[model samples]
Target: MTGKTTFEIFLATVPGLEAVLCDEVRHKGFRSPSVVPGGVTIRGGWPEVWRANLWVRGTSRVLARIDSFHVTHLAQLDHRARQVAWADILRPEVPFRVEATCATSRIYHAGAAAERITRAIHETIGAPHADNDDGVLVRARFDQNVCTLSVDTSGDLLHRRGHKEAVNRAPIRETMASLFLRQCGYSGQEPVVDPLCGSGTFILEAAEIAARLNPGRSRHFAFEKLATFDAEAWERMRTVKSERIPSVRFYGSDRDEGAVAMSEANAARAGITDFVTFARATISELQPPEGPVGLVIANPPYGTRIGDKKSLIPLYRALGQTLLARFSGWRVGIVTTESGLAHATGLPFLPPPAPVPHGGLRVTLFQTAPLP
Candidate 1:
């Protein structure tokens, strides 16, 4: 595969958030973005793949769809997998790994499919293979005897962002945080406040967006090690910075002093300490910052993850009362697993999106117009 060879690139997202991620991809100017079952698909070449890894905030992984074919059994899978030009993508010196999943197919054994593909790579490209932990990942999905192979250009999950080293209990992932912000109509024009901030994922993501910092700037990607990678061009793409000082600041507060400290430290690592503020305060004590009536969003503790429902009801109630009373003209977004907890806020929420899985719980973002 050459740098200019156009092909299908998939942006994988949480199942329920596919449309939101599709909007982001379209906004970023990727060509022919279409929502698929588990993610969004767009057509692009190698540079677009790099940009997707470097720029997209809502996607968990960026996959280069290299090849696809019909296969009924393991023998056909092995033959077609070996027929792929693996040497064009995988460097012989680099280690690689294959992952396969089968659904409603004659080749129902994922392990056997993976083994055949692994052997194909070894025989064709001469690259060493590793287990779950290491290697450049090659993914195969078999559905109804049709198999599509993709290269996972993202080595680590995009949420890692290579900055946050500390987190509180049941903390939200950065990828989800960013998508939630976009769903809340945040475009970096207004300040963001997170009263229940745990390690400040939402606030940090907001600050970076406002400052126009690239989400993947501090991280490395699997694409950098591919045979098609051009070091000079990658550096040029990576170093092209247009960051600005944000006009408004982001704020986060938590009752736990340790959580507050972690948020502060995380902001520093993300290089947005100058644009974000952290404080220790209870839900009752939470108040909007002085300058702007912007967005107040939070991922508070729901009964399933932290405290019991009985104990958290009052906390939710206090959060709702505070926002309703003091945050007039400011929008609000609260994410929680329990409908009762969301209702407890009493923040005049509009209809919510479908619940998306997060940390083993299905959480929904309950949003509101400017609070009444």
Candidate 2:
């Protein structure tokens, strides 16, 4: 594999997260990234994929597209599976696994399909097959009468930054919060406050970005074990750093003291504790930083997984009144699975930009401008 090996990279995200994920990829310096429904597809070799795994903060998983073909039946699936140049993609010495999904095709038995694909790779490519339930997963999606094959370059979801030791009920994913922040036009230049800062995910994500910290710097990726992986090139790309430093405008507070402490610990682990302030304060008593215009972003509980909806209405109303009263000239972004709950904020607000699917639920990212 030489001469700028071209491979397909599939970036996966929750539904409606495509735009933000695309923006993050472009921000990380990918040239002409293309957006698809559930992800963005870009053409690059191992270097680009490696950098994506390291720098993209908004994506759920990064998959390298190795092969694809039309499969109407089990025999056709076996034939196409055997035809792929598996030796180029998988090393005979490395142990691997296969995962498959099928829809709208004659190959309806996903287990049998996966078994045939696995056998082909094992016999033809000489790659050892690992049992299911292993950490590493190879995903196969059969949709619209086409079979798409990809290898999960990310061992775990990218949002599991391994530093969040605790989580509150209805906690927001760090990646989702970061993408929502960007969608709200956060440039990290002004104060960012998360009032209902469960587990401190939003604040910590902002702090890390403001501090110019790479999200993947502390984690390992599956591509590191690939035969075509270039160690020296990966190290060089990983070592590239920006000279930007974080300011003290980032803050987070929660009514729950336990959440405040968890946010503090997460910030410390990410090495941005100095750039953020966490406090146990209710939304009614929340105060903006003493400065110019800034951003207030939060993923308040929606009574779906955690709290009582009837009880949370007061919290939402208080949040709305507090922001309207104290946060003039500042920008606000709120994420909630229930728009009706978000509407209780009661600020003269525009309709949400769009609703995005998150964790088997649909969430809308709502924004508002401070009054004159």
The lDDT per prediction is: 0.92, 0.82
TM-score of 2: 0.94
Q: Where is model 1 more than 4 Å wrong at Cα?
A: 1-4, 305-307
Residue 370 accuracy (lDDT) in model 2: 65
Off by over 4 Å in 2: 1-4, 305-307
Pairs of residues clashing in candidate 1? none
| lDDT agreement of model 1 with the native | 0.92
246-331 per-residue lDDT for model 2 (tens digits): 66568899888998988898888888877889999978789888867788888887776545877788888999999989988988
The alpha-carbon deviation from the true structure for residue 348 of candidate 1, after best TM-score superposition, in angstroms, is 0.8
Model 1 worst lDDT window (10 residues): 301-310
Residue 85 accuracy (lDDT) in model 1:
84
TM-score of every model versus the real structure = 0.97, 0.94
* lDDT (10s digit) by residue, model 1, range 1-372: 444479999999998999999999999889999999989999989999999999999999999999889999888888888888888899998999989999999999999999999999999978988756668999999998899999999999999998899998878999999999999999999999999898999999999999999999999999988988999999999999889999999999999999999999998898998999999999888777888789999998887645597689889899999998889999999999988899987779898888999988899999999987
Q: Tell me the deviation in Å of residue 73 in model 1.
A: 1.7
Looking at candidate 2, what is the lDDT of residue 267?
82
